[model samples]
Target: MKPSLLILIHLNDASRASIEAAFDVVYAPDSTRRSAAIAARGDTIRAVLTNGTTGLTAAEIDRMPQLELISALGAGYENLAVDHARSRGIVLVNGAGTNDHCVADHAFALLLAIVRDVPQLDRATRDGIWRDTLPMQPNVSGKRLGIVGLGNIGEKVARRGAGFDMDIAYHNRKPREGSALRYFDSVVALARWSDFLVVATPGGAGTHHLIGKPVFEALGPNGFVVNVSRGSVLDTAALAQALVTQTIAGAALDVYESEPHPPEALLTLRNVVLTPHVGGRSPEAITASVDNFLANATRHFAGKAVLTPI
Candidate 1:
């Protein structure tokens, strides 16, 4: 018999069909349903499928004492209870590179939108305010772009920046040895040199609030910032203050610290553009993520090391 699995995220028709075909699937009704369902069939569940933000708790894992593996449907597994799962001898995996391009695309999209003042322009056009009434926005071409954490998504963002003839410089935990791209040893240094700063780092204790007052201050009054990475990477309160005081020119973000709900301060700002944490989401990206999940799960049960271990 196929191993029983619990799916937490909302899936489309195609995803649901694929998951059901491979596992004895169970649906989590909601957060409440999760505890109830786990309690009822704790010993029966062999695996749990979830996303980074909608993580499976240690308590949830405890309820299913028989669980051998946990899977993150996307790249970000920030909220996953990794220590507990690791202690229990359960393999944890994420779909890291599966959605890199999608997220990279979104990062540039946000960058362009905010820098070019697309939203304000659209609103102005709708309100019958002609282009002449608006101040001219800067051109994206031939600008300096500084990227934080040049991993898979960061590299993709750099590639896109190259297409725009923008000079690319990056800062990571360590210099990406032997790489040809210009390297900045600090976030403040990177922000100082960049006309646009794009953040694509992984989030955890190590990166929490990596971009804060100092970085924003370095960005100065003419620089723009875009965060396609996690929200905690930037200080939301400081960012809001920066926008309000014009410390930075403008900002765009696809993720926020409050998650499903954005910070109350950001809603009142016109200099910032926000999205509901959908940087790596697309039909293609979602489908690829599920495929990675299935592949990792299958390999784990088959006694092989999983791909993209978190």
Candidate 2:
């Protein structure tokens, strides 16, 4: 018999249909359904599919005594109970490189949108306000761009920055080997040197609130910041305060601390731009991610090693 799979995140009809061809799927994309499905089918579920944000907990794993595999749909598995899953010998995998370019594209889009004041300008134009009445925006090209966590997505962001003729630097736990790009030992130092700061770090306790008052203060009044990583990486309260006091010129984010619900603190700020954590979402990216997941699952079920193990 095909192994029963429990999916904790939303999947489009096509993606769901594809997965159904290979396994008996128990679809539960929300809290109510998740609880009900787990209670009813936990004994038979042999695999679980989730994203970083909608992670499977240790308690949930305990409920599913037969679960042997856990797959995160994206690069992040911050909320997954990785340690507990590992102890249970559950095979863990993620869609690491599948959405890197899409996220990088969205990060650059946010940078341009905030720096050029695009949203505000469009609104003003709609109100019949002309260019002469508005403040001039700064040029995005030929400025220093700082990146935090020089991973796959960060590398893509750097490539895009190069196209704009922007000088780029990055801060990581250690400098990436064979990379000629300038590296800073500290995030504060990088922020101090950059006109634009883009955060692409991982989430979880170690990186929670990594961007706060000190980093914002270092970014100064003329700087702009963008985040395409997990929301926990940037403190929303600190960000709102920075925007309100103009600690930094402006900020843009695809992720935030309060998710699903809009951040109430930043709602009134004109200097901030927000998107609902869609940095890695695109038709191309989604297809690649689903394909990767299917490949890994197929290999695992055939008694072969899985790809992209976390």
Candidate 3:
């Protein structure tokens, strides 16, 4: 018999089939089961397949007395009850490096859309206005690009910037050795020097609101900002205020504080672009994420070390 595992989030049919082939996959009670789901199969589950945001809580973990493994399908385990999992001797793993390219692509898309004023241009053209009346858009190529958090996704963004002949510099918690890219010691310094600032840091207490008023002021009037990382990495309120006051030229975001709903402040801003945090939703990224989770789970049950442990 295959090992039994509990899944907390909905998955594509193909991904579900893959899980079924490897484990006796059991889903949470119902799409709308609420507290009753935890009450139902809590004891029977030996492992859980979930994402970072829809994490299994401590209470849920307590109900699942047999659970030993907790897996996050994405890099974020922000909301996961990590301390409780660590205390219970549960093996915690996350799917890192699974969607680097997808995220980088989305980041670039947002930057281009905002800097080039794609939405406004489209509206103007539809209103019978021609390009001659519109002002020239800023050139994205050959500019100074600042990357926050030089992780896998940040590196990918830097590579893309290089392809465009743009100079790339990064700021991280510690300077990385053996990299040819220029490094900035602080986020404020990077923002001060950059034409475009891209945020690719992880989401958690350590990084919450890392980009706020000070960084925004540093970005200056001609600078642009793009955030493809977690929403908490940049302060939403500050961003809106900066956009309104023209503290920055323009800004684009794929993630926000409120899930499924955007902040009311950003909705009225013409210089801002927003996406529903779908940066890592491409087919390739999703496949890699599921494969990463499965491989980690297999290695874990086999008593080998799990990949990308938190």
Candidate 4:
């Protein structure tokens, strides 16, 4: 008999079909359905699929006594009950390299959109305003780019920055080994040195609000910031305050604390650009992630080690 799989995140029809071909699938993409599915089918499930934000909690893991595998469809597994799962001897895997390029591309898109004031300029042009009447925007090229994480996504962001002739640096708990890019021991120092700061770090308590008022202040009135990482990594209240007081030139984000609900405080701010947490989403990226999950799952059920263990 095929192992039963419980999927806690939304998937496209094709992706669903692909997974269904291998397992007895239970689809629950929202809170109500998730609770119901777990309560009803928890005993039958052998594997679970989720993303970082819609993580499977320790309590939920405990409910699934038969669950031997859990997989995240993206690089982050911050919300997953990793230690609890490990204690239970459940296998953990994530799609780390699958969506890095897509996220890096979106980070730059947000950076350029905010830095160049693209959305505002487009609106002005539609209303018959000319460039001569507007304030000049700064060039994205030839600037100092600071990355908050130097993982797969950060490395890709750095590579993109290089294409724009930007001098690049990064901040991690410690400097990444063999990296020639300049490293800052602290986020504040990196912000002070950066013309554009892009946050691609992981989430969880260790990094909660890692970027806040102090980092914004250090970034000064001329620097722009972009966040493609988890929302909790940047403080929304602080970002709104910074924009209101012109503490920073502008900001762009694909993720924010409010999530499914738009951040109310930043709604009226023209100095910021927002996307609905889609930095790592693309047809290509989704396909790759799904394929990676299937590969890992297939291997795990066949009594082999899974790829990309978290």
Candidate 5:
């Protein structure tokens, strides 16, 4: 018999079909259904498919006594109860590198959208306004780009910035060994020195509101900020205030603190651009992430080492 797998996130038909071939899936993408599934089939469930945001709790893990593996479909696993799962001897795996390119691409898309005033300009043009009447936006080339985290995604963002002739610098917990880009000891310092600040840090308590009023102030009135990482990394209230007061030139975000719904504070602002948290989403990315999960789960069940153990 196929192992029972509890799915805790939405999946496209293609992904569902492929996964269905290998396991008996309980397609519970919400709270009520998830709880019911665990209650009804807990003993038979041997695996779980979830993302970082839609995490499997210690209590939930406890309910699934038969669960031997848990897999996060994407790179971010900020909310996952990793330690507890490890304690239960359940193998944990994530698709860390699967969506790096997609995220980097989305980050640049946000940066360019804000820096070039693409959305506003498009609207103005539609309104029959000419360049002569509209305010001039700054060039994206030859700018100083500051990246908050220099991980795999950040490095890819740097590579994209380089193509635009940008002078790239980054702030990490410590200097990344053998990295050629300038390293900043602090996020504020990096923001102060940059024409654009792109946040790519991880989520969780350690980085919650890491980009706040101080960092926004340091970026000055002409600088722009882009967040392609987790929403908790930036203070949405502070960002909205910055836009209202023109504390910064403009801002763009792929994620915000109040997610699944547009931030009420920045909804009416003309200087801000927002996209649903889709930085790591693409057909290619989805396929790669699904394949990564299948590989890890298959190996674990086959009595082999999981490929991307968390």
Candidate 6:
């Protein structure tokens, strides 16, 4: 019999089928079902699949005494109990590069959607409003673009910015090796220097609420902010206040403090654009991520070193 594998995130039929071929999957995409699966099949489960957002907890890990590997289908593992898992000798891996391009594509999409006022313009056009009544929006070209993280997705966002002839700079804990993009040691400083700010940083305690009132203030009244990273990185209360006061020109977000539910405070605001967290989601991205997971899991079960261990 195949090794029992517990899955804590939702997967489409094809993806599930692919994994089912390799392991006995307990599909539990919700808390109730997850707990039930853990209680029922904890003894037999030897591997688990989850994403950054739907992390497996230390307690859950403890329940799965047989679990030897935990795989995140996407690049992020922010919510995963990394130290705890490491202490238990559980092998951990994430699909780091699998969805970078899709996320980068969505980041630019959000940036342009808000910068060009696409959604509002579409509404106005449908309501018989004309160009004479709309406020003039600035060009995306010839602007300084600031990235909050200089990782793979951030680099891709910068490359897209370059296509529009925008100057690109980034902020990380430290400057990335061999990167020529201007680096700021602080997020507030980067925001002040940028015409557009795009956040793609990691989530978790280190980055939670990193983009709050101070960073918003630095962006100034004419600047725009875009976030395609984790929602926890941006504070909803601060963002709502900033939008109401016009502290920043406008903002676009693919992810925000609230997930699964829309941010209530931002709902009534016209200057902000929001998307459900679909930044790193695409058919191509999903396939690549699952394929990466399967390869890593296969290597581990075969007693070889897994690729892309976190």
Note the Cα lDDT for every prediction shown: 0.91, 0.96, 0.89, 0.97, 0.94, 0.94
On the 0 to 100 scale, the lDDT of residue 144 in model 6 is: 96
Q: Write candidate 1's Cα lDDT for 45-127 as tens digits.
A: 99999988888888888888789999999888888899999999999999989999999999999999999999999999999
Off by over 4 Å in 6: none
Q: What is the C-alpha lDDT profile of model 4 across 1-310, one tens digit per residue? A: 8999999999999999999999999999999999999999999899999999999999999999999999999999999999999999999999999999999999999999999999999999999999899999999999999999999999999999999999999999999999999999999999999999999999999999999999999999999999999999999999999999999999999999988899999999999999999999999999999999999999999999899999
Worst 10-residue lDDT window, candidate 3: 29-38
TM-score of 5: 0.98
Local accuracy of candidate 5 as per-residue lDDT tens digits, 92-151:
999999999999999999999998899999998999999999888899999999999999
Model 2 Cα lDDT, one tens digit per residue, 1-310: 8889999999999999999999999999999999999999999999999999999999999999999999999999999999999999999999999999999999999999999999999999999999999999999999999999899999999999999999999999999998889999999999999999999999999999999999999999999999999999998999899999999999999998888898899999999899999999998999999999999999999999999999
Model 1 scores what on Cα lDDT? 0.91
Candidate 5 regions with alpha-carbon error over 4 angstroms: none
Q: Clashing pairs in model 1?
A: none
Please give each candidate's TM-score: 0.97, 0.99, 0.95, 0.99, 0.98, 0.99
3 or 5, which is superior by lDDT? Answer: 5
- Candidate 2 vs candidate 3: the TM-score winner is 2
In model 6, the clashing pairs are none
- Say which candidate scores most in lDDT: 4
lDDT score for candidate 4 against the true structure: 0.97
Q: Candidate 1: deviation at residue 250, Å?
A: 0.7
Please tell me which model should have the higher TM-score, number 2 or number 6: 2
Per-residue error (Å), model 2, residue 262: 0.9
Counted clashes in each candidate structure: 0, 0, 0, 0, 0, 0
lDDT of 1 at 25: 87
